[model samples]
Target: MLNRNNLYFIRRKVTNHIMLSLTFLSVVLTVLPLLLIFYYTVTKGLTSLNLDFFIAMPKPVGEAGGGMANAIVGTLILIGIGGAIGLPVGIMSGTYLAEFGNNKFGNVVRFLADVLSGIPSIVVGVVAYTIVVLPMHHFSAFAGGVSLAILMIPTITRTTEEMIRLVPHSYREAGLALGIPKWKTSLVIILRSAWKGIATGVLLAFARAAGETAPLLFTALGNRFWSTKIFQPIASLTVYIYDYAKSPFTEWNDQAWTASLILIALISLISLLFKFLTRSKY
Candidate 1:
C-alpha cells in the first residue's frame, strides 16, 4: 500500500508539470505572432514615417513625398460621430437591461445584442448604405459613421450590462436605504463604479471601428482631397492604406506601411488615454 501511494504521487507530479509546460508553450505561440507583426510593421513603416506624412496630403499618381493628414482627421471624425451616436444609447440600454430586464423583453434584447455582435461588418455597411446612402443618393461620412455606430452598439451594451451587474447588490440596497432614488443610484453610483470596464469596452469598439475598411468602402467612399463635411465623402486611414497598398507604385506602398504604423500608434495613444482617464483617483 505504501509503495502504491508513492507511485501515484509521482505520477500526479509529472502530470502537473506536463500541463504547466503545455500552457506555457501555448502562451508563447499566441504572443509570437503579435510580436512578429509589430516588429515587421515598425521596421517597414519607419522608412516612410516623417513629419510630412502627418502634415501633407496624398500626392497624385506617380508623385512622391506626400502624407495622410486628411485621412487621420477623417478617421478621428468618424470615431467621434460614431461615439456620439452610440455611447448614450448603448449605456442607457445596458442600464435598463441590468436594472430592470429580468423578463421576456430583456432576454429578447440580450439575444438580439448577441446576434448583432456576430453579424459581419460588411453586412452592416450594406445596411447603412441602403438606409443612409440611397436616400441621400451618394455615399458620405454620415453613412460611414452610422455603420460604425451600429457596430459599436452591441459591444458597448453587453459590456456595460456585465460591468454594471458586477456591482454588489449591497451597494444598491444601501443607496435605497439612504433614500436615494433608484434612477439616481443606478446612474451615479452603479455607473461610476463600473466606468472603468465600460471605458475599456468603448476603447475596444473604437479600435475596431478605426481599423474597419470594407464598411467604409461602401459608405464613406474615399476622397482624394481634404473634406470634413458630414455629407461629403471622407478620407480615412484604413481606406487610404487599402488604396495605397493595392497601387502599383512603390511610393504608395511605402505610404501604406507608414499609414498602418500611424493607425496602430493612434490606437495605442487612445488606449493610454483611456487608461489614464480611468485610473483610480484614490
Candidate 2:
C-alpha cells in the first residue's frame, strides 16, 4: 500500500545503494592489489636503493657499495634494439590490416597475429634460443632483442590495427574527396588522427618488453660486466632481479629488491606518460 512518491523514493534509494556497492567492489578488486604490491616493493626494495646502487657495478656477495649500471644499460640497449626491429614492421603490417588488406590474406594475417599474441613468453624465448642463440653459438643482447621483438610485434600490430580502425571513416572519405592519393590519405590523415592511440600502444608495448625475463634468460645469459658489444651477453634488470633474488647471499637479494623497485617505477612512469599523452591528444 505504498504511495507513488514512496515507491519512487524506494527505487531511487535501492539503485543508489546498488551503484555504491558496485563502485566499492570495483575499487577493492582493482586498487587493493596494486596498493599491496606498491607497499611491499617500497618497503622491501627502497632500503637497498641508493646512488651507489645506480652508479657502481655489482659487488661480491657479502660486499656492498655497488650499482646496477650494467644491468640498466643492458636493459635499455635490449629494449631499444627490440623496438627498432619491431616498430616499423608492426606499424606497416597494422596499417595494411586496417587499410588495404581486406581480403583472405588479411584474415590469415590477423589470425596469425592473434595466435602469436597468445603464445607464452617462455615459448618465444625457447624459439629464440634455438634459432638465434644456438645457431649463432653465443648468448647476446642482440639475441634477447630479437626475442623481445618477436613478442612485441604481435602486441603492436594488434593495437595499431585497432587504433587505426577507430579513426573515423569520414576522415578517409574527406581526404579522398579532396583528391588526395589513397595511400597518402591513409598514411597522413587517418594515421595522424589515430596517432594518440598508436603512441599509447607503443608505450604499452615498450613497458611489456621492459619487464620480460624469460626471453632474456636464455638469449642474453646475464653478464655481470658492462658489455658495449651487441654480440656479447648482457645483463638486464629482469634477469638481474631473478638471478640476485635466488642467490644465497643476502646482499644480492637486497640488490634484487632495488632493481625490482626501479623496474616498477619505470613501468609506472611509462604508463602515466601514455595516459598524459593520450589525454592531451583529446
lDDT of each: 0.93, 0.90
Best by TM-score, which number? 1
Clashing residue pairs in candidate 2 are 56-67
Q: Across residues 18-55, which tens digit of lDDT does each residue of candidate 2 receive?
A: 99999999989999998998898899998889888878
Q: Which runs in model 2 stand beyond 4 Å of their true positions?
A: 1-19, 272-282
On lDDT, the leading prediction is 1
How many clashes in each candidate?
0, 1
- Local lDDT at 161 for model 1: 96
Instruction: Supply the global lDDT for candidate 2.
Output: 0.90
Model 1 Cα shift for residue 258 (angstroms)? 0.8
| Candidate 1, 1-282: lDDT as tens digits | 569889999999999999999999999999999999799889989999999989999889877799999999999999899999989989998999999899999999999999999999999999999999999999899999999999999999999999999999998998999999999999999999899999999999889888899899999988999999999999999999999899899999989999999999999999999999999889
